[model samples]
Target: MARITAGIATSHIPALGAAIDLGKTGEDYWRPAFAGYEWTKQWIGQNPPDVVILVYNDHASAFDMNLIPTFALGCAENFQPADEGWGPRPVPVVEGHPDLAWHLAQSLILDEFDMTIINRMDVDHGLTVPLSLMFGQPQAWPCRVIPLAVNVVTYPPPSGNRCWALGEAIARAVAGFPDDLNVQVWGTGGMSHQLQGPRAGLINREWDNRFLDQLIGESDALRHIPHIEYLRETGSEGIEMVMWLIMRGALGRTTRCLHRHYHVPASNTAVGHIVLEPVS
Candidate 1:
């Protein structure tokens, strides 16, 4: 059976690539941002998993507001890098693990978890930005990726409890796979910041830190946090932190924090990163 070895949470700030590419890491504004992921990069180098199940939301890139699924799983052989307003990043297309993805999809649905199975789709910065920060643009990705795209753009999306339930379902699905492989699950987005309308550029450091503490130590408390409270307190977009609960639920109740980093003012967002190793 495959064991989930690691869990990671990260913020997918679109401008992060440009900041790194421009060699601005040493600059006052960007230095701390780059510093945050350094420990995660080192850990990956030492213990690279064979597969990664990445959970992220597409920002009206692949699935426009026209049609959105609360939870979509990618089972395609390959996925194209989306051409956002500027253009697609110069990186090799992401290859998916169809065998594992299909198995996960089938099992989750059988378990009564409604998931949208996507045979084909393109991914934007939501997925790529974290990839670049964690692994950089190598000739090819270090491991196969099972992309899980969540719908947070629509007015009403999956609730925090629902996302956490999905995470538990995912853990069971991965554990049941017959293959002998190591897998890492990643939840990307949010640390209390908003983007949109006049409420843009909002950041609540106090709530952000408290959320992180509860996420790692007392996540069951998160289940009680209502959707309206997340919106009102964290900002509409900040509600995306609910996605992190999914990742947290997939790991052991007690996980060792391997790395953590947080920053603000990244194109009107608060960027945060954390890596965890399952505790036995």
Candidate 2:
């Protein structure tokens, strides 16, 4: 049966993707931030998974305020990059694992999680940026991807506890599959930075680092964090960190943080990334 071998959490800042696409990563302003991921790229190249279940939010690209699904799963054979205002970030089309995605759709629904099954949808920076951060600028992504879009853009998003439960369910579903494939669950977004309003340039490094520490060691208490606390401490957009619970919850009872990277001032956002795997 397929198994979730590891979990990854990261912040998907759009400017990071732009720096990569525009050949500006070598510049001094972006060099330090890019340097942090060099090890991860090498690590992933040596240990590639058959498929990656990427959890991220849509930035008014695929789903607008008119139609927002609390949890949307991509079941199509492939997904196109979305054009967010300027244009799509010259990235390869995302290939989907329909067999596994469909199975997850069925399993998750039966497990009482209402998921909007999507046959086709364009993916935005929220999804592609994370891929770029890990895999670099390849002609095509190394492995198939299943897009699990969560609604953190709008108010009343899923609670941390609920996201954690969904991750647990996904692990159970992957284990039930008969194929002997290695899978990775990735939660992308967060580390505290806010845009808009009076606190437009907020970056609470202390709180962000503390959150990361708790995530690595005290996730049970982390999941209970209220949304208002995120807004108050990390900024409004910092609420995206809640998605990390999904990745953490899927990693079974015990896990060790193999790698952790944290950087600041990347497009006014904190870049946080961590790699975790089951202890046994």
- Please tell me which predicted candidate would have the highest lDDT against the true structure: 2
Tens-place lDDT per residue, model 2, 81-179, is 999999889999999999999999999999999999999999999999999999988999999999999999899999998998999999999999999
Model 2 earns a TM-score of: 0.98
- In model 2, how large is the Cα lDDT of residue 27? 98
- Top candidate (TM-score): 2
Clashing pairs in 2: none
State the lDDT at 278 in candidate 1.
72
Residue pairs with clashing backbones, model 1: none
Where is model 2 more than 4 Å wrong at Cα?
Answer: none
Q: Write the per-residue lDDT of candidate 1 for residues 99-152, one digit (tens) a residue.
A: 999999999999998889999899998888888898865889898899999887
Clashes, model 1 = 0
User: What's the CA RMSD of model 2 in angstroms?
Assistant: 0.9
